[model samples]
Target: MAAVVTALVLLVFLAGYRFYARYVGRTIFKDDDPNFVTPAHEFSDGGDFVPTKRAILFGHHFTSVAGAAPIIGPCVAAYWGWLPALLWVVIGTVFMGAVHDYGALVVSAREKGRSVADIAAKVISPRVRLMFLVFIMVLSWLVLAVFAMAIAGLFMAIPTSVLPVNISIVVAVVMGWLLYKRGVPPLIPSLVALVLLYVFVYLGTKMPISLTDVGLDEAASSQTWIIGLFVYSAVASLLPVWLLLQPRDYVNSHQLVVGLGLLFLGLFVAHPNFDAPAVRMSEEGAPAMFPFLFVTIACGAISGFHGLVASGTTSKQLDSLEDARPIGYGSMLGEGALALASTMAAVAGISLVAACKLPGQGEVLDLSWAVYYDSWAHASGNKAAAFVLGGAAFLGKLGLSPLLAQTLMAVLVISFAATSLDTATRIERLIVAEIGEAVGVKALSNPIVATLVGIVPAYFLATAKISNGAGEAKEVAWALWPVFGASNQMIASLTLLVLALYFWQRKRPILPLLIPMFFVMVVTLISLFMHLVSFWTTKNWTLLAMTVVLVSLLLWMGAESLLAFTRGREQPDSGD
Candidate 1:
C-alpha cells in the first residue's frame, strides 16, 4: 500500500506538471521562438558553445543539478515523517523549483546566454549584480567543499565504491573522444560505457579496496581522498566540455535511470510497510519542520544552484528555445521523483538498528520516531549513510546478497557526489573568471589560475575542523550543513525575484513568479534568523558571520529589487 501510494503520488504530479509546464512555456514565456538564434548556433565555436542535441544536454543539466543533496535532504527531513517531506517535495517542485529553473533558462537564453547574475545588472542595477555574484561565489565555494568531503567520506566508509567511481572517469574520457572527436553515434557508445561501468560495480563488490588496508588511519585516509578529489576536479575543470563534462554526465544520467528503476521495482516487489511515523513533534535543539524543512530539502524542491546550472551551462548549449521546457522543467521534476524515492526509503527501510546514537546516551531503548529524528538531525555529514543502509535493505528484500547490495548502493552515492563535485568546480571556475574580468584582475581570467582560486579555498574549508556540541572537533562540512541550507534557499529567492522582474518588464503575468518568490523569501529569512540564534548560542563564530553576510546580501538585493518594481523604471534593453 505504501509503495503503491508513493509511486502514484509521484507519477500523478509529474504528469500534471508536464502539461502545466508546456502551458506556461507557451503562454507566459512565449518560449517557442523558432526564429530566435540560440547562443550555441550564434557563436558556434568548436568549444563550449557547440550546438547540442536535446537528449545529451538534458543529461548534462539533470546530472549536474541532481546531486547527493536531494537524497540527503529528503532522508534527513523524514525526521518530521514522510508526509511533510512528500508534500513539500511535490508542491515545491511544481511551483517553486521548476519555475525557478525554467525561468532562469528562458531569461538567460533571451539575454544572449548570460548568467542570471550577469542579467541582474541589466534588469535591476549594477549594485545588485555585484552582490548576487558574490553570493553565488560563496554558495559555489560551500557546494564544492561540502561535496568534496562527502565523496571522501563515502570512499573511506564504503571502500568498494572507489574502483568503479575511478573507472567511470576513464570511460567518460573515452566516450567523449569517440562521440565528439571521432564522430561516433552517441546512443550505442553511451550504452556500452554504462554497461562497462556496471561491470566495474560487480568487480568492486568482489575485490573491494580500502585506504586503511594500506596502513593509513581513518583521518589520514580521508584527507588523502580529499586531496585526490581536488586534483581530479582541477584537471577535469580545465578540459573541454565534450571531452569530459558532457560525456561523463551523459553516462551518469543513464546510471540515474537504471538506479531509480531498480529501486522502484524493489519497492513494488518488497512492498515494505511504512515503519516510521507520519509526523512527529519537534524535538528541543532540533530544526522544526515549518521553515527548516523547506530549506533542508532544497534540491529536491527548489535550489538556487539549479539556476546557476540552467543559465551558466545549459543555456550556452541549447540548440533551440523549445529545449528549455524539457531540460529545465523536466529535470527538476526528475529530481523531485528522486526525492520521493528517498522519502520512501527512509520511512520504510530504515528502522531501529540503523537509528542514530545520541550523544551521552549510549544507546536509545525505545527506538521510536523521536529517537530516529534525533539521531538523523545530529548525523549531519553522514546522513546519506542512513539512506544507503535503507537502500541496501530494499535490495536485500529483493533477494540480492546483502554485501553486494550495500556495495552497489555505495557506488551509486559516490558516483553522484563525484559528478557534482567536478561540475561545481567547473562552474566555480567560470564564475571566478567572470569576476576577474569584471574587476580588471588579469591573472584571474586565466582558466588555470581561476580553477586554482576556486579549488584552494574549498580545500581549506573541507579540511578545517570545528567544535561540535559535545566540545569535540568535527569536519567543517558537517558544522556548515545547517547554514548551507539557508544560504541555498536565499539564493533561490533572489533568483525568483530576478525572474519576476523579467516578467514584469515584458508585460507578461508576474503573479506566478511573484508568489513563489515571496513565499521563498519569507521561509528563507526565518530559517536564517533561526540559524543566527543557534550559531550565536553555540558560539560558532564562523557560521554566525556567514549567516550575517548572507542575510545582509539577501536584504540588500531584496531592497534594490523592491525599489525597481515599485518605481516601474523600464530600463533600456541591452540588445541580445
Candidate 2:
C-alpha cells in the first residue's frame, strides 16, 4: 500500500510537470523571452542580486520555501486521515501552489525583482501596495518567530542534529568562497560538502552537543538555543548570498534528495500497511477537517509564504526570464514530493517498528500508527519526531542502524528549518525596507536598520508567554498558531489575486489561476471565521484580536482585487 501510494504520486506529479507546468508557462503566461535581461544581471552587486545558475537557484528556492512545514503539517493533518492529506497535496500543489509561485516569480522578475506586495502596486493600486506590504510584514515576522522557535526546540529534542546543522554553515561558507572567488566548479565542491556533511552526521550521533554541557538548565538551554539561532539569522541575513545562504541551501537540497530517495526505496522494500484509517471525518478533540485541513497542510499543497520566497529571493537571483518556469513551478512540485513522503511516514511508516505507549490500556504496541495516533494530542505533539522515527524505521529496512538513521533524518529536518529561518530573516529585511519606503521612514531603509526592525519583534514574539487559564504560562506563538495558518493561506489567496489580475490585463489565459484563487480564498476565509468563533467562545482574546486583524487585511485585499477587476480592468501591462 505504501509503495502504491508513492508510485501514484510520482506519476501524477510527472504528468503535471510535463503538461500543466509547460502550458501554464507557455500559453498562460506567454513564455518569457530568453533575450530579456533579468534583475539578477541588471542589478548585480555581488550581494542579493547575483545572477545564478538554474539548478543552483532551484536548490536555494526549494529549501527556502520547504522548511519543516511540509513534514510537520502533513503529520498533524494525518489525524484526519492520510487520503485527504494526500489528495490535497497532489491537487493543491499542481494547481495553486506551483501556479502562484511561478506567477509571482515571473511577475517580480519583470518588475525588476521586487516582491509580490510591490507588484500589487503595479497590478492594482498604490494604496493596495501599502496594505499588501503590511500584510506580508506580519506574515514574514511570524514565520521568523515560529520557525526559530521550532528549530530551537528540535535542537533540544534531537541533540544529535545539533553539530551537523551548525557545521553546514561553515561548509557553505567555504563552498561559496571557492565558487565565487576561486572560480571553482560547483559539482566537485558540492559533492565533497555532501560527504563531509554525512561525516558530521555520524559525529553528531556520537557527540551530540548541548548547551546543558555548558551548565545551562533545560529552560535556560532552550532560551540559549533560540538566541544563538537568531544571531545566526542576523549574520546570514546580512551576508552576501553567495557566501552562505545560497551555497548552504544548495547543499541542504541535495541532502533531502538522497534522504527522500532512501525513504521511498525503503517503502518499496518494507511496504508497510496503513495503521490509521483511510478517511477520518471527525476526530474526537480535533477541529473539523474541512477548512482546517487546507490550512494545516499549507506548505505541501499551497502557501502564501512560497510567494514571498519566490519574489523576494529567487526572482532577484534568476539568470534569465525563462528560468522562472522551472525554478518557480518546478520547486513546488519537489516540495509536493516531500509532502507525500511526510504523509506516508506518518500513516504507514509508523507501523513498521515496535514500541508501547498507552499505559494502563494494555496497548502493547508493535510500532503501530494506531497506538501512537490514538489521540489528537499525541499525534500533534509528536509531528516532527513522528517523521524522524518513522523515516528512521524505514531506513532501518535498508540496513542503517537506528541511531544513524534517526540522526540523519533529524539533521535533514533541522537543516531545512534553519535554511528557512535565515532566508525569512533576509526577506524580512527586504519587506521592512519596502514597508519603511511606503510609510516614509527613510532610516528604516538602511539594511542594518531593516534587519533589526524585522527580527527583533520575532524574538519577542517567539518567547512571548500568555496565561493558559490554569495559572500556567504558554507560548503566545503557539497560541496564535491556528490563526497563523489562516493568515498564511490568505496570503497565497491574495497573491493569486495579484497573478490573476496580472494575466487578466495582458489578455492571457486567467481561468487556470482564477479557479484556484477563488477556491483558496473561500477556504481560508471560512477557516478564519471558524477560528474566530472558536476563539470568541473560548474567550481567547489575544488570538481573537489577531484573527480579527487578519480578517480585516483579507477584506481590504479582496476589495482592492474587485476594484482592479471591475474598475481597473483597462490597466495596461508593465511591458519590459
Candidate 3:
C-alpha cells in the first residue's frame, strides 16, 4: 500500500509538471517568445540582481520557500488525518500553488524585478501599495519568528544538527568567494561542499554542541540559540546574495535531493502502511479542519510565501524569462513531493515504530500512530521529532544505525530550515528598507536598522513566555503559526488577484487564474475571522493586533480590487 501510494503521487506530480505546467506556461503567460530582457541583465548590480544559472537560482528559490513548514504543517495536521493533508499538498501544489508561484515570478520579471507587494497598486489600486507593503513586512516578521524558533527547537532536539548547520555557512562563504572572486565554476565547488557537508553530518552525531554543554539550562540554551540564529541571519542577510546566500543554498538544494531520495527509497523498502486514520472525524478541541487544514499546510500545498520569494528574490535573479516554468513552477512541485513524503511518513511510517512497541497486528498499528499523535500536548513544537523518528526508522531498514539515521534525518530537516530562516531574513531586510524609504525614515533605510526592526520583535516572540494551551509555558511555537498560515495564504490569494487582473487587462482568459484566487481568498478570510475571535477572547494581544491589521489591509485591498475591477482597466479606478 505504501509503495502504491508513493507511486501514484509520483505519477500525478509528473503529469502535473508535464502537461498542466507546460500548458499554463506556453499560452497563458505567452512565454513562447524568448527574446526578452530580464532584470538580472538589465539591472545587473553584481550583488542582488546578478544573472545566475537557473540551477543555482533554483537552489535559492526552492530552499528559501520550502523551509520546515512543509514538515511541521503536515506532521501537526496529522491531527486531521493524513488524507486531507496529503490531498491538499499534492493537488494544491500542482494546480493553485505552482501556478501562483510561476505567475508571480513571471509577472515580477516582466516588471523589472519588483516585489508582488510593489505591483499591488498598479494592478489593484494606488491605495494598495503601502498597505500591501506593510502587510508583507508584517508577514515577513512572522516568517522570521516561526523559522527561527523552529531551527532553534531542532538544535535542541538534535544537538548534533548544530555542527553541520553552522558549518554549512562557512563552506558556503568559502564557496561564494571561490565562485565569484576566484572565477571558479559552481559545479566543482558545490559538489565539494555537499561532500564536506555530509561528512560533518556524520561528525555532528559524534561531536554535538549546545549551550547546555557549558552551563546554560535547557530553556536558556534554547533562548540563546534563537538569539544566535537571528544574529547570524541579520549578518547573512546584509551580505551580497552571491556571497553567502547563493552558494550555501545551491549546496543545500542538493541536500534536499539526497535527503528526500533516502526517505522515498526507504518507504519502498520498509513498505509501512497507513497507521493513522484516513479521515479523523474530530480531535477534541482542535480547530475545524476545513479552513485550518488549508492554512496549516500552506507551504507544501499552495503558499503565498512562495509568491514573496518568487517576486522578491527569485525574480531579481531570473536569468531568462523562460526559466520561470522550471524554477518557479518546478520548485513548487518539488515542495509538494516533500510534503507527500512527510504525510506518508507521519501515517505509514509508524509501522516501523509499532513493530517494536505493540503486540497485536491491527490495533497495534493504530495505537502506534496514536502514541505519536497523543504525545501532541508535550510535543506540539517539536513534532518534527515524529518525522525524524519515522524517517530514521525508514533509513534503519537500509542497514544504518538508529543513531546515525536519526542524525542524518535531523541534519536534513535543520539544513532546509536554516536556509529558509536566513533567506527570509534577507527578504525581511529588503522589505524593511522598502518600508523605510517609503516612510521617509532615513534611519530605517539603513540595512542594519531595517533588519533589527524585524529581528528584535522576532527574538522577543521566540523567547516569550506564552501558554502552550496545556497551561505549561513552553517556548517558541503555537503562537504565530495560525496567524502566519492565515496571512501567508492571504498573500497568495492577493498575488493571484494581481495576476488575474494582469490577465484580465490583457484580455486573456482569466478563469483558470481566478479559480484558485477566489478559493484561497474565501477560505483564508473565513479562517482569519475564526482565529480573530479566538484571539480577542484569549487577549492574545500581539497576534490579535497583527490579525486585526491584516484583516484591515485585506478589507482595504478588497475594496480597491472591487473598484479596479468595476472600472474596467481605465480611469484610475475613479478616485480610490
lDDT of each prediction vs. the true structure? 0.81, 0.86, 0.81
lDDT of 3: 0.81
Error of 3 at 199 (Å): 0.9
Better of 2 and 3 by TM-score: 2
In model 2, residue pairs whose N, Cα or C atoms come closer than 3 Å (at least 3 residues apart or on different chains), thus clashing, are none
Q: After superposition, how far is residue 274 of candidate 2 from its true place, in Å?
A: 1.6
Clashing pairs in 3: none
- Residue-level lDDT tens digits of model 3 in 252-292: 88999888898999999988778888888656666778888
lDDT (Cα, tens digit) per residue for candidate 1, span 470-575: 4778667667777777778878888888888877887777777888888988998898898888878988777788778878888899899888887564643543
Worst 10 residues of 2 by lDDT: 354-363
TM-score for all predictions?
Answer: 0.95, 0.97, 0.94
Q: In angstroms, what RMSD does candidate 1 have relative to the true structure? A: 2.6
| Evaluation by lDDT, superior candidate among 1 and 2 | 2
Model 3 RMSD in Å is 3.9
Best by lDDT: 2
